[model samples]
Target: MELKKLLEQQSAEAWEKYIPSLSIDCVIFSFYENALHVLTVNMKDQNLWGLPGGYVQKDENVDDAAMRILKDRTGTENIYLQQFYTFGNLKRSESAFEAYDDSIWNKQRFVSIGYYALAEHSQVKLRIDQYSNAVEWKLIETLPEFMMDHRAIFDKALLTLREQLNNHPIGYNLLPEKFTMPELQKLYEAILGKKLNRGNFYRKILRYDILIKLDESRKGGAHKAPDLYSFDLTKYNEALKEGLKGNW
Candidate 1:
């Protein structure tokens, strides 16, 4: 009853229970230290990598199936997940995942729905499934060769994420419960893909009036400690409803 065998049997069963055309792909983004990264996995003997994804089951809701896949891959649940785009181009899966030994996978074409979520990097412990030989976070800007149209999917997901930041505070998922102002600004700079003026960024963010500055100071090294703060979720939600403008 090895996981590999179980997964192989499940792959056979997938032909019967899973949709022939529809699938789900997750772009889990995490802000680690000062850089942004995406979760990627490579199958056995395959040099290419792609996002965490799976097929939709016949009786299951697509959203539920997506959540299950995310939990199985990242060991994290309850994080907010948003469905962003559906990739329906013909031959989207052509020649993808070809290194796998499973014959069933080669028998069909798949159109995948792309979903995305952000999580605190420190909170996640990756769980590789039977199909993947290894898993790691890769820099979005310098990703390796991807299978099929996953490169296009990643690009769309990044664009969608940047758009979400402009209208929502969902980016908070990428940080710890308490953070310094510089930490928050660093996140914006990473997502917006540009540096911002320190004075301007601080003033714009402070105008939201949703952060609770704590008396504690950020400590790790000998650098001068900065005051720590946490966002008031109630006020944050209200501000999100009003939609945050890109002043930075």
Candidate 2:
């Protein structure tokens, strides 16, 4: 069967298995090549890209549904996920399915639960489900045209992430187990979308007391290898509870 036809058929089945007028959209983030990237999908027959998303099953809790959706796309259950916001602006997603019958589930007015997830870039195995032709990471700075109000959804997710930086442990899920101070700084800069003074960044991050300096340095560059460090998960979790003071 054709992809559109398959989607049309699923639209009928969706009403029976999933809650109507409710959906989940995930903004999965990763830090790679000194930039922040987001996972996106290209629909099979459309010239549009969108966040990886899915419907909420009638019997599942909303947070569980979001986790299931994230695992489906990223192939991991260990991602750091947060429920950031809800998007329900009028007609937010209805027009994307105008070519289909009004009864189509895709055409319904859905208020999406927004989630922001952080996964290590190397750990994620991007998967394309039945509805998408391509599932790939796009740099947050240079995203393709998005369908419906997905761009708005992405914008809001990014904003929420930035706001959380002051109080949250961000790089635990986004960075590798052992990373250089410069590398960690770059991740913070990527998320904050600004350049930070090296001295200030080092002092502030060290003061947080969430990282442990390893007895090693990164090897490869002609210049002196940078010192390596890893998060003290115990301290990190403690900081998460108490929240680090001050802002970027």
Each prediction's RMSD over C-alphas, in Å, is: 3.0, 1.8
Tell me each candidate's TM-score.
0.90, 0.95
lDDT tens per residue, model 1, 1-248: 44345556677677788888788999999887777899998865555688889888889999999999999988989777889999998777856544346465443578899998887788788987667778999887789888878889988988888888856666568878898888888888878789999999899888888789998998888888899999898888777776776233
> Model 2 compared with the native: what TM-score?
0.95
List the global CA lDDT of all models: 0.81, 0.88
Candidate 2 local lDDT, residue 159: 88
State residue 27's C-alpha deviation in candidate 1, in Å.
Answer: 0.3
Task: Give residue 58's error in model 2 in angstroms.
Answer: 0.6
Query: Any runs in candidate 2 off by more than 4 Å, and if so which?
Result: 246-248
Among residues 3 or more apart in sequence or in different chains, the pairs in candidate 2 whose N, CA or C atoms overlap within 3 Å are: none
**lDDT of model 1, residue 191:** 80
Candidate whose TM-score is highest: 2
lDDT string, candidate 2, 1-248, tens digits = 56668878887689999999999999999988878899999988775799999999999999999999999999999899999999988899988777888888888999999999998988899887888889989999999999988899899898888888756667887888999888888888888788999999899889989899999998897999989999998988787776666334
